[model samples]
Target: MAEPILTVKNLSKSYGEQQVLHDINFSLQKGEVMTMLGPSGIGKSTLLRCLNGLEDFQTGELVFEGQTVKADNANWQQLRQKIGMVFQSYDLFPNMTVLQNITLAPVKVQKKSKAEAEQAARQLLKRVQLSDYANSYPRELSGGQKQRIAIARALAMHPDLMLFDEVTASLDPEMVRSVLDLIKELSEQDNMTMIIVTHEMNFARQIADQVLFLDQGTILEQTAGKDFFTNPQTQRAKDFLASMDF
Candidate 1:
C-alpha cells in the first residue's frame, strides 16, 4: 500500500469550555478524495478547518507528508501554501476582477511575477470554464461562477491538498451540480487530494474514495464510500443515512 500523504491521530478541538471534536483520526493518500458526512454542527467543518490550520486544536497530531504539524512550531504560512481551502461562501474580493482574485496569492505570497501569475490564473480560469469572466467583478457572477473562481484562485497556488468546508451549501439547487462537477473533474484529471465536508450524499458517494461519518465531533465510522452507504457499521451512521433518505 502507498503511504498516506496526510494523517491525523487523536485529534480533538474545543471552543472555550465546550468541546467540538473528539479523538478524530483519518488519513488521505495522494490523489484520494475523502468526504466528511454528518449532521449540522457536528464538527465536520471544524475538522476541515483544523486540517487546514484555520483553527487550532487542543490535542492530537497532524502529519503532513512526513513532518508533524505543530500549531506553535509549524510555519503556518508555508503549510497553508501546501494546503489550500475553499469555504461555503465564495469569499472573493468584490473590488477585484476574477483574474485579479485568482492571481493575488501567487503574486504576493509565492513571489511570482505579475505576468507569470496572470498567465497561470488565465489557464486555471480556463480549466474552470471561466475564461471569459476574467475581467468580471464578483458581483457580476452567479453563485456558481463565483465559487468556480474561488476554486481557480485556490488552484493558482498549486496546493498539494485541498480542504473544502461545505463548499456547495450556499449554492442554489441548480448551481450545486456545476460546482460539484467541477470538483469531480479536478479530482480525476488533476489527481488532486481533497477532504470535503458536504451534505450532498449522492455526490459524496460518487466522488469519494473514503467516507468519514462524524457525530457530535467524534468519528462514528470510517469506511469505503460504497460500504458506508450500503452497510454502515454504526447506528449513528445508519441514522445519518436514513435521515438523508439514502
Candidate 2:
C-alpha cells in the first residue's frame, strides 16, 4: 500500500468537561475516501474539524499531505491551503453571487488576479454542473444548487484533501443525489483524499474505500467499506449496521 497522504495520530479533543474525541488515529491515502460513521453527537464533525485544523485539538499530530498541522504560522497556512472543508449547511455567502463566492478565497488568499480567479471559479462551477448559476445569488438558488456552489468554491482552492461534514445532511431527499454524485465523481477522478462524516450509509458503501465506525469518542471498527458493512468485526459496528438496515 502507498504511504498515507494524511496521518492522524493520538487525535484527542474535548469541549469543557466532556470529551468528544479520544485518541483517534487513522491514515488516509491519496485518492481514497474514508467515511466516519457514527450516530448524532458522537463527535464525527468535531473530528473532521480537527483534521482540517478548523478547531484546536488538545493533543494530536495531524500530518496532512506531508506537512504537520500545528499552531506554527507557516505550517498552519500551508496546511490550510491544501485542505478544504464543506459544511452541512451550504455556508455560501448569501449576498455574493455564486461566482463571487467561489472566487473570493482564491483571489484573497491565493492572491490570484480577479480574472485568474474567476476563470478557475467558472471551471469549477462547470465541474459541479452549476456553470449556468454562476451569476445567481445564493438566495436565488435552490438548496442543492447552493451546496453545489459551495463545493465549487472548495475546489477552487485546488485542495489536495477535503473534509466533508455531512455535506448533504441539510438538503431535501431529491437534492441530496446531486451533491453526492459530484463527490463520487471527484473521488474517482482526482488524486484527492476525502474524509466524510455522514449518516448516508448507502452513499458511504458506494463511494468510500474504507469506513471508520465511531462510538463514545472511540473507533469501534475500521475496515474496508464493503467488508465493514457486510461483516463488521465489532459488536458496536454490527449494531450500527443493523440500525441502518444495511
Best by lDDT: 1
Total colliding residue pairs, candidate 1: 0
lDDT values, one for every candidate:
0.91, 0.87
Cα RMSD (Å) between model 1 and the true structure?
A: 1.1
Q: lDDT tens digits, residues 121-237, model 2? A: 888888888889889889999989988888889888999889899999889999999989898888888857899988888899998898999998998888975788878898888
Whole-model lDDT, model 1: 0.91
TM-score per candidate, in order? 0.97, 0.96
Score residue 42 of candidate 2 by CA lDDT.
Answer: 88
Model 2 TM-score relative to the real fold: 0.96
Model 2, residue 121: distance off in Å is 1.2
